[model samples]
Target: MQLTNHDAANPSYWQARWREGRTGWDLGGVHPLFSELMQEAHAAGLKPNARVIEPGCGRAHTGAALAKMNYIVTAFDVSKEAVDAAKVLYANETKLELVVADLFALPSNWSNSFDAVYDRAVLCALPQASRPSYVHACAKILKTGGLFLSIPFTKLHISASEGPPFAVDEANLESLFEADFEKVCHIEKQHSVKDSKIACEMLIVWRKK
Candidate 1:
C-alpha cells in the first residue's frame, strides 16, 4: 500500500526486470520444493492429468516441470518478456500453456477452474498492498478443496531488508487468508531461497473453506 513511483508490485517494474535480465530471483529452474509438492499432490489423489495453474509464472519453469509430469498446466506472467521466454522453452510441450496476462485481470471463465494453484515467490514479488487481491484471485480460480501451494520470500519480514520479494510473515498470512481459507498445515519452518541473498522463506498450504 506504500504508494511510490518504484513500487515492486507494479507490472511495469517486473517488465523492466525481465527486459534487462535482472531476474536475480530466477533459479534458472523450478523451485526445489515444488517437486516434493507435486509428489505429495499425486499421493493426495490429485491426478497428474488434472489442471493446474502457475500464477505470476516467471519463465514458467514450474509449469514446464508440471507439464513434464503429465499435468495440464497453464502459466501466465504480466511481463511479455518472461512469457516469451517460456514459450521458447516449451514450444512443443503439449501439456504446458503459457500466456501473457495479469494475475488480477485473469480471464473471468477461470473461476473455480483449477485443481491447484502454485506460487513460489510470486506473492513475495508483489507490494504488500496487492497481496489481498492476489489471494482472492487465486482462491477464485481454484476448485473446492484444491491445494494452494505457497512458498513466499520471507526475507523482509524475517531478515529486515527491502524487497520485491517483500516482507510477508506468518502473522500477515493468517490475517490475509483466514477469511476464505483454512490452513491445511502450520506455517512451515524457514527455508532458503537457494544460492540467493534471501535468508529464508515460509511455506504454507491452504484449502478453500
Candidate 2:
C-alpha cells in the first residue's frame, strides 16, 4: 500500500487508503511491546474488566487482544473500511465495539470514558503540525489518572523521500504529553521493520494527572 498525493491529516484520505488496501501501518497483529505491557499490568493486579480505548485503531488488533483479556474495549478509527473490518473480525465478541470516527472529533459519549488508552501508530501518523491537538484530544477522552500507553518512532534515520512512520524524538513526545499526564515510564527498544534503517523506538506510559 503506497500513499499518493493525499493529505495525511484528512480522514477521507485515510478512509480511501483503507478501502484501497493501502494500510502500510497495519502490523497484522498486536504489538509485542503492548502485549508485554498488558501482561505486566495484569501481573500487578490491574482489573481485567477495565475500560480500554484505542484511537487510530487501524484494524483494532490491540483492542481485540484486550477484549480477550476481559476488557471492555471501545476502539475508533478515521477510516470506515478499517472500522468495518474490525467489527467483522471481532463480531461475536461482545467485549469489543468498533466505531468509524476521527480521533480529534471523538464521539461525545466517549468523553472521560476510558480507564486506559492505547496509542500504537496514532501519534506519529498525524502530521507534526497536528500533534498538539491530537495529544489534547487523547487527554480529553481519558479519565483523570487514567493510563496511557504509546509506542512512537524515535531517533530513526530516514530519507526525506519516505515517511508516515515519522521520526519523533523524546523531547517532542515529552512536551506533548507532559501538560496532561505525568510520565511514569519510558522504555526504548531496537525493532526492525522491512526497508527501514530505524531499529530503535520508544514506548512510554503515563498517568493522567
Candidate 3:
C-alpha cells in the first residue's frame, strides 16, 4: 500500500488496499470524534433525518452509526470492494445507503441534495492537486447552509513527499473553501496515529453560504 502522489489519484490504488486488507485507517468502528462533531453540529442546529453524504467512505462505519442516530446517510467509496463490504456489514441499517461512486463525478440528482457532508478521510487522502475538486464536489452536493463536518489529519506520520494521510494546516483549509463556506466551529485535539511524531488533529465544521 505504498502510494505515490500520482498513484493516490487512481481508484485502483484504493481498490487494491481494500482487497489486500491494508486499511490502516479503518478503525473497525465509529470514531469518537464523529460523536463529538455530531453533538457540536446538533447544538449548531443540525438535526436528525437530515440528509448526509460521506465521500470516500471506506467500509462506512461512521455512516452506519449516523443512520442509527437517525440521519439519512448516503456513504460512497470509489472502491467497489469497500462499498460491498460496508453493505454487508450494515445490511440491516435501513437508513444507510452504500454506493460505489467517484467523488468528482457524483450522480446528477445529487447536486444540492445533501444537508451535510461528512468527510473523515476523503480530503486528506487525496493528492494536493485534487483538493480543490474535492472541495467543489462536496459543496455542489450540499444544499444552501448545509454543514460540512470534517476530521482531517493535521500532521503526517510519514514523509511529506509520500502520503494518503496528508498533512493539512488551517491556512490550506481556509483557502480551499473560503469561496463557498464559512468557518463556524473548529477544535484541535490530540490523536493516536501509530508511530506518528505529531499527534495533532482537527475537527472543523463549516457552514455553506
TM-score of each: 0.89, 0.90, 0.94
* Candidate 3 runs further than 4 Å off: 1-5, 192-198
Question: Mind giving the per-residue lDDT tens digits that candidate 2 earns over 68-127?
Answer: 889999988887789888888888778998888888777788888888888888777777
Q: List the residue pairs that clash in candidate 2.
A: none
| Candidate 1 local lDDT, 1-209, one digit each (tens) | 33343467678777877887988888878776776666656655578788999998888888988899888999999999989998988888899999998997999999999988988788777777889999999999999888788777555433334565676778888888898888875445456555454656666677887
Q: TM-score for model 3?
A: 0.94
lDDT of 3 at 155: 72
Best by TM-score: 3
Between 1 and 2, whose lDDT is larger? 1
User: How does each model score on lDDT?
Assistant: 0.79, 0.78, 0.86
The best candidate by lDDT is 3
Model 3, span 1-209: residue lDDT tens: 57555678788888888888889888788766777888878976889999999899998999999899999999999999999999889999999999999987889999999999999877888887889999999999999999999878777667657677777888899998899999988799788444354457888999899
Candidate 3's error at 119, in angstroms?
0.7
Q: What is the lDDT of residue 159 in candidate 3?
A: 61
lDDT of 2: 0.78
* Candidate 1 Cα errors over 4 Å, as ranges: 1-6, 156-161
Descending-lDDT candidate ranking: 3, 1, 2
